[model samples]
Target: MNDKANNIKRQIAITRRDELGHPPLHLDNNSRLCLNCNRAINDEINIIEADPACLRLNVLTQSASQTCVICNAQEDIGRLTIHCRVNVFIEVNIYIPDNVRSCEHHLDENGMFHNRLLPGLRFINRPYLIKGPQLQLFLQHLRNVSANKVKGIDDKNLTEDEFKCIAPVSKQQFEELFTYCDPVYYNGKLRQIKRKDLLMFLCKMRQGLSDDFLKIIFDYHSRQTVSSVAACVRTSLLERFVPTNIGLQSITRENFIEQHVTEFANELYNPRPAEPKVIAVIDSTYAYVHKSKSFRVLRQSYCFHKNRHLLKPTLIVAPDGFILMICGPYFSDAGNNDANIIREEFERDANTLREWFQNQDIVLVDRGYRDAVPLLQHLGIDHRMPAFLQRGHRQLSTEDGNESRIITKNRWVVEARNGHLKSVFKFLGQTMNLQHAQNLSGFYRIAGAILNRYHPLINMQDVNAEFARQMLQRSTVPNAIQARVEVDNLRLRNGQWRRLYGEDVPDFPLLDLGYLKDLTMGIYQINLAPSYIQDKLIRENDKELQLDEHINEPGFLRIRLFSRFRNVVKHQIFIAYTANEMENIDNNADNNPISGYYCTCQSGARSLGTCAHVASVLWYLGFARHQPNIKYPDTSLLDTTLDAAYRQPADIAQNINVDVIDIN
Candidate 1:
């Protein structure tokens, strides 16, 4: 009963296969036919293992595997195991060419043919059997003739080496088998499969072959092919990687100071002027190189200023060793004096400068800047020059050494700038011949700024006069304020004199004294007879000095401008003369010695400082009295009480009436 039940179940399963359009029952082992066409079936093939019974079987198992009844062709769908199956097939009517020798060479020895005798005879690599009678017959009428039209028998057996190369050895075998071969992707179908594409890929990876390198490696035909490959890589690197990140171009003052200044300052003493505690020391240097010998040299002009031949650039430096301005790289033969160049640059921005110079901002300079006074006057700037111990005035009074100390101590900045520039840019320090001069000029002007921006500044003096003065007055200052003191002092010194003269209470109208007898034929001031004026002034001075030989050393009188003020006060001249000698000299008469006086300005001193001709008249007319300290002190100090025998005091505060004059 149980056996009968099993037989029924098997019949039912077979019935289901027929219903699902499965392969025909009782199919031939070697001969085949399509389910749809019965006439000697031959066409392309497909192997599908979808049903439970066929799913675990290899496709090429012929009848044991599922067959495509529509084509009668077979396909192997199996996993690779590093080996191919040995097929000791019934080596039927296939001919092996004598030239194609094999490990197992004999075939059809018993006529029925031992398949094992023909190595790879059961299934070997496919090769066309075009001359075979069976294949020739079907190919003539085959549809899709280019496809796998089964027409010939491939009877080949696998040798031990060939079998192992095709399939990996395993300890056990199972009914289910896998057919693994080429992958879905052509480039990397099987990892170890050495296809043409695989070899090329490996060449790229191993050698890091760039397009050009690869082209030469493989002997590619043209530059266009290699260039196209390289351009893609280059474009990718530039746009996708390099451009989106930080690069080398972003340098600015604020960015630089923030990123580097603190770290740099900590490394050294590189505090900048922008920082509160730092000072900048600025100076100019020049660059020189060989040029044609026929270059033009600067012409010889008497530079009353330096009194020496020089090709110079005006380098204004800070007290802290920072360069403030490298004003020029001017040419010597360019017909520009130092003063002239300075004036031109000053006027170029006069209004801005005038606005900058307030009460205490100082400019330090050298004596070549005598014209500094006028230029700065227009700008409202104050300037200073070091005491030329030769000019011989009372800037440093002998009373105390304070004035001398102040002038000498602060004057080194300008000198240092001049010396520093000459030393570093040695060619510029000396005279230039001509050819390389202009290039050197540009170098000198620009090099300092470059040096200052890059090099270390050192030995900066802490005193910034403007900063200190403004601090006292409670004022704010600009970061790069170039309140050059000496340049301004020169102007202020002159301007103050002009103002002093302009503001003075008219002691006499600075008038047409040309009408006076000695002043005839020329515009003159407070003119008087030279001889008569001389007698009167000298006679008066003799009342005290007695115009003795002791007092009358050289000339009869000394004359200078009146109104004691900056540079010099006014054009109005004053004279103190001598008549009687204090001692009886053999050359002149006795106790009636003529009195003598002199002035420090141009009106006296043989017209170097001042002249005697003008001096005499100024003294004779008592214009000398207008000046408080002349040859003799003014007698205004004498009170009536001191003079009265009865001790009656002269009136004090006589001008108590309210009449105010505005000095400004």
Candidate 2:
């Protein structure tokens, strides 16, 4: 049996070498004669003498050991056995088919010749060095295995939600980007992972998933490989996607004016005559980072406001909430404040902000950019910011406060844009590793680019300039009730202003939500009114309500309600109700039963519409109270009565020095 196997192995080696372009070796006549089988090679048959060195075979003798015909026949059977094993291994989905064998040849009890090898030789345990045709076959088998594994990803087998969880874009969008990027290789090899899978890696990174978790989900062999793949994908996205979609240079001034600027042209306080062609809102957003080992870095990144290590990146967004450009991910130190960043941008002309911004082009900002105002003025750029309250004053004067509201109303979009970027890319929300601190800017820019291209406009529709103008006009109107309250010192005199409670709740004019929205000029405040009212009612234990009936104005009530935000502060508001004759209010008519209202809240002070505080009082008094036994939901999580530090103090009333007006 061993001799037969050896003879078969020799024949296979010779045949493989011949197929590999090696000429057949000549065999001597005596050497072609088999000693044990007693068969001689026929002269008509061509056969090669196997080289023991090349074949790695143990030949029993130097010559006449085996006949070429017997070897040839054995080689054919061996080849057939290997092919059968290969098919079985392939069918069973074996990744590496190293062992293949044929059945042992033997005589059965019935004297029939059964072609099967001995039991020991039937299945080979050793892996042979496969070459030539066998090597090609093995590679082809590997190809089949890989194809099956990646078939699902290539065919987009994942559902929409599943794809969304794994990638920022939809499957269709991913495919389109993949085609555009055409990333063919990664880590110096032909990419085994599909383009969608690569993008999934990037998306998962943005979602702030750990490498270990990603590896388990993506079926990666190691976390290091996952990191490498993610890095490669990030590089590709930065090189291929970010440039065209982000940065000031990517967009033309004409396009910016046409698409984003024109909408705010007629907006209140839009810096006209100069006819501000563009209005860009700028603000800095913080990204928390792990404390660094380097003391200098740790000190520089520490933010006094957040009480943590943070990186602040300044974002400039168009009125439509498009992120036009991203500036330095400057350290949170005082030197890198928003104003300083803008100053540096002007000095460096970063993204050509100085060149692109024309004279009288408006830059809407928060008070943080107060220092930049002088610089902007020097450049002939108009800057608008919310008015800051004087050190002792409780609120800005009517005109100053109203103009501040206009600035705030327009500036809020940039804040929303910043929030959108952080919310969509959770990595920015999480505390970043110290090691990855340098990559913060790259990630920020990339997230901004993605948002600019995919997210809906922050301000979905153009600002209603007419509504804004009306609001501006309303803001300038002096509040007669507030004026009267202040003149009579009604807030300080307890007898003049009685605590308004359950039975004292005045009759407020009933108005529908549409009418309320029209009065407020937006639904946000009206929608928030319920939650604010509920918070005052349930969370603050309804302890902050007061009414002044001393004024001779009939059907008018002056009340001071505790501020939802500040424990020690309260806002004075006025509500005017109509006579019973106006009970049946027409929804479509401009004239409503609610004749006039005012609240000291910045927005409420505006004449165009009422603030949420005034709206809440009217809704609760007129509509909500009439719907008897209906439970109002508590929308606030804060327990101001219990959680507030002032509430905890035993002498809280004395410390605050304000009357603890109680509401039943």
Q: What lDDT would each prediction earn against the true structure?
A: 0.33, 0.62
Segments in model 1 whose C-alpha atoms lie over 4 Å from true places: 1-309, 331-337, 351-360, 388-396, 399-401, 426-433, 460-664
Q: What TM-score does each of the candidates earn?
A: 0.26, 0.71
- In model 2, pairs of residues that clash are 31-64, 103-116, 103-117, 104-116, 104-117, 105-116, 105-117, 474-607, 475-607
RMSD of each: 36.5, 13.9
lDDT of 1 by residue, 285-373 (tens): 23222333433532333233545444546665544444545555554443565566677666775574334334333455555566656
Error at 620, model 1, angstroms? 55
